[model samples]
Target: MAEVEEIKNLETNKCKQNKRKPWDDGPCLDRWEIEKFDPSWNPSGMLEVGSFSRAYPKRREKHLLKCWPRVKSALEEHGVSCELNVVGRYMSVSKTKMTRDPDIIVKARDLLRLLARSVPARQALKILEDDMAYDIINIRRMVVGSKEDFLIRKIRFLGHNSSSLKALETSTNCFIRMQGNTVAAMGSFRGLKRLRIIVGTCFRHDIKCVLWMS
Candidate 1:
């Protein structure tokens, strides 16, 4: 009887040792807490922080109206709304305020900036044609100059409007314009080199020499 009692006591002890605690049965710690100890753990790449909208400076009302068609079309696709103050040039574009997704606002801003540069609605809208080309245009615009500079060159070109100058713009990517009597070539560095070669080879007599602004 004593031996049997001892055996029963031992079995009870083993069962008590095997019992699980409430805390142990549950998740001991959060996954993020465990991640701190893990060398290979990483957060997800697609985390959204907040609304991606901001206050943009109001531009010329006439300018906005000129590019209104392209602007309206681009923003309408994303369901974004824009308000304009023609007298003050105070235009505001927002998305989250109206409970709409703000993902496409960045592209809209790009188009707006392009228009603000005095780029024609036709050329500004071309940004929507190809994503790759749009990226290139952004880089080129940054490096070359502002849209204002390009507009100045364009105005000069129309005054001359010669077939040969148009061909130069087409062939060499250099938009040749008259700066007084001399021909000024404005374009990317590559276009400038090609223009120089063309001037040296074929049109030295007519153009004298091509000058580029550094």
Candidate 2:
């Protein structure tokens, strides 16, 4: 009986030792699979080794830093200034995440008008607004989104100046809206104090986010 008990204990210990691995938890595919790896049988049809995906996981800060500088530089090349602010929720002893959700936001007025138009513009505005309003004050700034991406929405792309005015009134409070056909400015952050509250409230991406304002 004692011998039998000892054997059972050994078996249980071994079972515990077989811990699950990272790949066992979730597959990392979004990072990009390394292609043309197996150059033996078919030199042209090599399968992806998946080095990049395997190398790191997506962490918001890292990803933003990695891409943001290049993106900012590119924008400057075209004569548009760029800025980024970040807000943090918490810190964790995490793994190799390459990208993370943007806690910091980027913002600029009519920044992308020259590049593209419409849905892409609206999408960019929405993302920017969401991030800016994030609780992380240090990292909060209204960042601009890509007009190319904005084109996807296709709906809140454009509006007659008169209609947008109605939207501004019904959408937010105490803010002034100056949208004369094309350019727009819808914000409660008016008159001197620059409260940024009223506009903050009614600020919708496409439907309400101002086109341009002086």
Candidate 3:
């Protein structure tokens, strides 16, 4: 979580726009500090491609077909090993039903992202807290740095619900947030990339002024 905050302060809020996003196409090393980046620094690029769909470039129906395998392979190639878990589904054992899962899931962050414009944070944090518990349980076997150390970049946040995040302060990187409660994005700015997409309306409609997260 702290690492995510640190990245938000780096490139996302720099206001230095280019043809490609810093995350999707930029080097991991800082441009000013290092002349050459470590060639081995090959973390999977956080794919927050557009304002509407996070990581999901298109509709979620083809999520399995499009995003998962490439990301999984890329992480493995760089030797980042963690269980690949899909955490967004609610199953029905009583009868067969459609199973909708986001493209990729890291931890509890998916709750807000998967919500789209559905629920409010005040209403949803409970579930998110539980999911966080589940997240820690699932990743208890992680052998590397703590969960707060992992970096997230170039992700999208589609809704206006900025409950606890410091997104409004302009410190984060490549955030691409949709302002206010409106489903459509207000504009793009930089923050840690962790936006998600789900089926129903689950968040506020427009971006509010001056977040309380700080």
Give me the candidate number with maximum lDDT. 1
- Please give, for residues 73-108, the per-residue lDDT of candidate 2 as tens digits: 543432333444344321111111221211211232
Q: Which stretches of candidate 1 lie over 4 Å from their true place?
A: 1-60, 66-70, 96-103, 132-159, 162-165, 172-214
| Candidate 3 segments whose C-alpha is farther than 4 A from its true place | 1-61, 82-214
Alpha-carbon local distance difference test for all models:
0.45, 0.31, 0.28
Query: Could you report the Cα RMSD, in angstroms, for every candidate shown?
Result: 28.0, 24.4, 18.1
Off by over 4 Å in 2: 1-145, 151-165, 173-214
Tens-digit per-residue lDDT, 1-214, candidate 3: 4543454454344565634564665656443331323323434443332112223222332443334455334334322322322354321111011111122223123433433333233332232221121111111122135433211100122223443223432433222223232221111111222221110101211111222133
Q: State, as a TM-score between 0 and 1, how close model 2 is to the true structure.
A: 0.17
**Better candidate number, 2 or 3, judged by TM-score:** 3
| TM-score per model over all chains | 0.37, 0.17, 0.22
Q: Tens digit of lDDT per residue, candidate 1, span 1-214?
A: 4443443345445566647566655556432221112212322212332322233235445666767766766666555566555655555555533223333455555555555554456655544332211221221132245656554543433335465557667777654543322344445455665565444322221221122111
Candidates sorted by lDDT, descending order?
Answer: 1, 2, 3
Worst 10 residues of 1 by lDDT: 205-214
